[model samples]
Target chain A: MITIFGKPLLLLYGQLTLGLINGAFYALLSLGLAVIFGLLNIINFAHGALFMLGGFVAWALLEYLDIGYWPALVLAPLIVGVFGVVMEKTLINRLYKLDHLYGLLLTFGCALIIEGLARNEFGSSGVPYPIPDELRGPLDLGFMMLPAYRAWVVVAAAGVCLATWLVIEKTRIGSTLRAATENAPLVQAFGVNVPRLITLTYGAGVALAAFAGVLAAPIYSVNPNMGANFIITVFAVVVIGGMGSILGSIVTGFGLGILEGLTKVYYPQASATVVFMVMVIVLLARPAGLFGKA
Target chain B: MPMSRRALLATAAATALPVRPARAEKPTLKIGVLTDLSGPYKDLAGPGAVDAARMAVEESGLAAKGINIEVLSANHQNKADVGASVAREWYDRDGVDIILEVANSGVALAVAGVTKEKNKVYINSGAATSDLTGAQCNANTIHWVYDTYMLAHSTGAAMVKTGGDSWFLIVADYAFGHALQRDSTDFVQKAGGTVLGAVRYPFPSTTDFSSFLVQGQASGAKVLGLASAGTDVINLIKQAHEFGIKMRIAGLLIFLTDVHSLGLEVSQGLTLTESFYWDLNADTRRFADKFARRQPGRRPTMVHAGVYSSGLHYLKTVGDMGLAQARADGAATVARMKATPTSDDCFGPGSIRADGRKLCPAYLFEVKKPSESKGPWDYYKLLATTPADEAFRPLSASACPLVKA
Candidate 1:
């Protein structure tokens, strides 16, 4: 008979792989949210709906224009980003001077309208999105099988996160964006076009979310409720990682996912609540979070 | 006589003539169709159930009998409070006499409580928890269509009898999954099987199932039982295939909708038990044809079919005896339903069990091979039939308070 510890190690590796896939999604979504929050200081409650829109756009592109995954990966984010730019200009820009909670409420209303429209059009049943032929099969690890699409998601997500971090930290234009985040008026006085920068930043954030949605379409069901279900957990992830830290969000997202996977292997009942429990403990011990700056 | 006096005398004579009493308006029997119109179960029950209720009304000819069948719907959003409030509003203000097609068990159980309080009849066709008929049994609520017990009995018992005795469970971590796993395990053990071990999975989990599949493979169980439904089932099956856990797998509570969603590539050769299949019999075929006309290329799910059958019977009862009297005498109406052989487009000649679970032959279906070369919707080939007697839990085994009474 196999010992409990002996089986759990193999089980832990399996869960970690699964957790990493989920963490990839969390990292992508939170990275976008962090970018938007850094400049705008308004939590985009409609982020989930925007992610859902990305999937819908991909589905529509496939159904209407015979567009496939490669084009959709490029097209969905661009289209959704344009919409986000318009949203920032028309609706979100007006609430910048008010309490941050007002912006949250406004975004919440927008989310409702978007989700309601999707529900009306698609009904509740999810439509299947076929995986691209290249990403269809599994890679046989000696101990476990790895899905090609899932492995791609992890690699692509890490690439996106690192790219975003490097651009913000190293580039001159990124320094201007950071300066605008600190004081928009001061940056504007220096001819930085802070408002336009803010709008572009918001659009970029939304585009990232859409990109994640495109990545997730083949893995999960493309349904209206898909984003709403995941957004809450992402919010918890963001909170636990601290909203301000870009690298913190990415690291915590992936780490927590592996932790959740391990819990599923050893104690499955607590898998759902384990992340939340970790969040609570972090809040009590170190409110700034592990990677968060004080 | 004078001219004016003669005119008055004629008018008085006309007024004095006897007139026939105005025909009494037939009492309208209000039926409320409550379901999750905008929640997780919406696709399963939402418009499909409403369409089912409409079909039942048309079939029963209740409109011709001066029975006003008013169908009211609401989106409960899977909240017990919203469901109960809707039931109350329908009962108190809308004059709703019967509530049908509640999908969420939490909402269904709450609505059952409200129906009991209001003395209105509830025909539950959507909720799967067996407790509505068990500990929470109400005199006015009937557990229609399917429940956890039926699912466990048919799938688990049948597997055990076939000598696939040892069991491992991949259960969703919730009340529904827990009940399904527990009930099915009991049946497995009673049929001379051993439950090796079980694993709980969180609801809406999107990660890989390699870990859980590995656990099941290590358990050394001959049969791996999945106690979750919908996308969870799809993911589990897909992962199980990828991991190559070739144990005899059984889905304890899979629906035709689940099978359709999964398609043959993933679901092929899997054994599942279902009370109704669109291709089962001539009567079912006819019903599917009519249902397809309304929904356009979608066969009615068992729950949708259940709504139609339960609604038709309820209307028949209302037509035979008035709504007030039907509510006053619950058992008599159920007795009438049992005595009468029900023939519908969905299921033919089905009867109601004493425990209120509709009795019909359930089929163990194996997903057809890819080479079967049939058109769309030609998914399953029937394996074996569990006759009505063996299809559901026996009344003696049911712990429903009413059964003991």
Candidate 2:
């Protein structure tokens, strides 16, 4: 019966919860983008397509190999990660010496080609991916009936983001990767295998995207345009969180998600554009982003 | 005969230069299919529409009747500006006499304006806005297949009668979605149902509908009216199933392709209405099979079927009143079409009203369950059929300028 700003508390709680669920995806996706941009200084526009590829891979695995969601959770990301590695060695590696614009252009082109191919192979309507049996039903959360799969997404994404944050900010491998990003030639001089580390970092970032894609498969239609739909928002998250600020992205992603969720409740039509609106405000005030070291 | 001499002269002209004939020896007409080839509604009516129009041209027997059909197509990309410019170019430079299947309602309206200004025929099959046959109806346009009015009446009234007496409308914020929502609301109210609430979400982008779905649940409405089409409706239903929301969903403008995208398990028990089903009859089955051969592993939606039906009817009109007459005067051609009762393999027998509204029976269908479905693409099972006259907005209530006040 409680009210906040004349809206029911129960309504606010429900929308906020749903917003956090969306925030989980934004956090996970932007976390990957942050890692790659931090280490490689490359804006990976192909991240969305890679995410779509992950969903498609999971779909193909189930369709062809009779594999299910649990196995696809691991296999899809691994498959997409390897694709990332191969792409780095053959195509993306060449772009490192050029301006960052080249890398962005290259990856954007890659995204278009990938999406076009998917449309041709599977048509525009896209095919279905079933919700895992364990996560099929809703769990009564008092305020609302939250789907168990959505709850799993929030939990899994937070866990993965925390783990990624730990590896980057706390571990020995993380320090080496950081050092290599700071001075790749010097790290190579010190015998750290910097080139290989950079390639692996890109692969890891892409793997995270694929993992999110796999997570999204059951909930959203596995359409080619799915990535196109989400990627622009993820890029905005990366920008607002500060291009390579890890914790910043994680926080901003969830925060903006809550904001968007509230928009859906209050003014449903602006819910989709609310994130970008916030991005413009943040960029105007803090040019280097909320957490960026200006 | 004059036809053979005209053919010889045309061939001679073809070898030398492109020729424009003044009168009939044989009538030649160019067709352009402007549709959403690669956007949100692409799956609903894209290249398949073009293909269906092509089929109609081939099957019209117009070639034997000494008519030349050249079909050209373009992706409108669901943009009104893009559609209008393409239509203008098709009419002016390419000599396209008729434009068919401008899919998006906004784009369809835009092309309708251009077709009128240019005095070219437009037989729209994809768009669902009833405004085409109502306040904004034009002499150049014949709204073929179905409209929001018919779909709304069939599904909305049917749902209310079946005890889904209260509604929450989840509308796509667009011309088509608005029209669907408005029409459905009227029918629901007339059927003694109450509207609990409504929400309009941004179209072509709002992929996540969990918040909207939860809001619908919060209203405690018995039925959630979906005033949207294509994957928007598909994703909403999928998310609704995921949330295990207790409210029944009434998808007002669902397409065959949208149901196919959702699969049987998720879309089962969802009821909708359409003018054409691939399995409606032997003739439809035959039409679907030929279409499938052209677009392998895929069957046509009602929009696609409508494209064929309208194209076939248009060709019949051209054949009936020689192609030259049909080509020169768009209004006169539309008048002739309205005067004659149309019969085709897809729509069976139908008629076009003076308001350019195509009259045909609308079938209420429930999506078959996983167990009930015999095979892939075996989606809908008919529940009821609304007779042609009662299916649409009656002439007495028409707001079209063509309909005498």
Best candidate (score: lDDT): 2
Quote the positional error of residue B381 for candidate 2 in Å.
1.9
Provide the DockQ value for model 2: 0.65
TM-score against native, each model: 0.91, 0.95
lDDT of each: 0.81, 0.91
Q: Which regions of candidate 2 fall more than 4 Å away from where they truly are?
A: B1-27
| Candidate 1 global lDDT | 0.81
Error of 1 at B379 (Å): 2.3
Report the error of model 2 at residue A194, Å: 2.3
Which pairs of residues collide in candidate 1?
A: none
Can you write out model 1's per-residue Cα lDDT over B71-150, one digit (the tens) per residue?
A: 77788888899999999999889878888999988899999999888877889988989888777876778776778887
Estimate, for each residue in B200-292, the C-alpha lDDT of model 2 and write its tens digit: 998777888999998999898999999988778888999999988888889998888888889999999998999999999999999999999
